[model samples]
Target: MEKIHYRGFWRSLNQAWRGLHYVWKTEGHMQFHAFAGVLVLAGAWWFRLARWEWLLLFYAIGSVFLSEVLNTAVELVVDLVQPNFHPLAGMAKDVAAGAVLVTVIQAVIIGIGLFWLPMWRWIGG
Candidate 1:
């Protein structure tokens, strides 16, 4: 594993921001994700979930973004290589989309679980 140092934290932040910029630039889906993140973060704040719950939220957000980036890459490569539709190309695109679907579903479940307690308390459940 790569050793992490506080001294390089700013550099790490820059790298992550650049990745976010690329995603926002290339993928329309990322806009929706940014909106969703804001909404979920609001809930997370209200819920006051444990540190581990916040960790889970972060994990879900990162996982979805990673899957989205990969999906974008796959579509770009496949389109460049095979402009004409082919069976395997279709399959590749389908598989990439499937991955995004799976990731989004998982993230939704985690978000709901993370906010459930706060929601219940507010609802007097």
Candidate 2:
């Protein structure tokens, strides 16, 4: 295996941006997650969430984003290495997708917990 040379800080940042751009360009699910996250942010603003609530919301959103990015990385690496249909490769992709699903589910639950009371109060007034 060849050792990778360490690039400067700016170069590392550029590479990270490139990875994000590629994923955002190619993955519909990532776009959907981003859209949902935006909505969550808007909801938090409308509700005027407490500082702790805002922190939790941000954590939840970040978790989803991280999981989705990791899933994409796994899928890309698996495809590159395998390049052909194999049961194990399929399983790898499926598990990665499952991870994203779990993240989304938890995020949704956190959103509900944080918003339910505020939403009801706003609606009642």
Candidate 3:
């Protein structure tokens, strides 16, 4: 195989493009999420949420995308190695999915904590 030159830069760009495509298309939940994330940021900016709140939002988005990419990698590796149905391979995929789920849940909790009360007050609820 020919060696890739400027591989670090190329690799970063490739990964970024893949992630953009993945978030934009492949992940069903991710589309809604990206939208919601945008809305949250807009609200935060409008409301002038604290720096820590913005930090938490950044972490939330990072966690979801990172977990998703890791999960995709796990699934791909499992398929490449097994190439057929196998209990262990299934377990590997399940575990990866679980990791994404865990991140999503944590992000949701943090999001609620960060946004919900302020939203409630804004609505006078």
Candidate 4:
């Protein structure tokens, strides 16, 4: 195993940002998630979501984003270790992607549940 270095806090944050930048640049899924997140946030603002609702929405969105980043990391590491196509490597990537799909589905359900009544009331008014 390679030795790990302990970087300062600011350096750590910068490195994290760099990884996010790379994902944003290379991954279309990340871009779509970002756009969807923005739309959810906008809806929250428009509806004046309750504190609990805000927290739930944040958790859902954060989980999706976290899963996406982790999935990307898993894919990168798998590719690095196994440059050629392998069944196990493909399986690993598929599992990671499945995690992102699960989170996205959860987020969508949460969004619909929280927004449904408010949206209907707004429109009905």
Rank order (by TM-score, best first):
2, 4, 1, 3
Error of 1 at 31 (Å): 1.0
Best by TM-score: 2
Per-residue lDDT of model 2, residues 1-125, tens digit only: 97766677679999999999988998998899899999999999998999999999999999998998899999999999999999999999999999999999999999999999999999995
lDDT per residue (tens digit) for residues 1-125 in model 3: 97867979899999889877865676776677677779878988988899999999999988887888788878878999999999999999999999989998998899889988788989999
Per-residue lDDT tens digits of candidate 1, residues 101-122? 9999999999888787789889
Please list all clashing residue pairs in model 4, or write none if there are none.
none
- For each of the candidates, give the backbone clash count: 0, 0, 0, 0
Q: Which residue runs of candidate 1 sit more than 4 Å off their true CA positions? A: 1-20
Which clashing pairs does model 1 show? none
Total backbone collisions, model 3: 0
Model 2: worst 10 consecutive residues (lDDT sum): 2-11
lDDT of 4 by residue, 8-122 (tens): 7679999999999999999899999989999999999999999999999999999999999999999999999999999999999999999999999999999999999999999
lDDT of 1: 0.88
lDDT of 1 at 57: 91
Candidate 2 CA-lDDT value: 0.93
Which parts of model 4 have CA positions greater than 4 angstroms off? 1-7
> Which 10-residue window in model 3 sums to the lowest lDDT?
22-31
Candidate 4 or 2, higher TM-score: 2
TM-score for every candidate vs. truth?
Answer: 0.81, 0.91, 0.80, 0.90
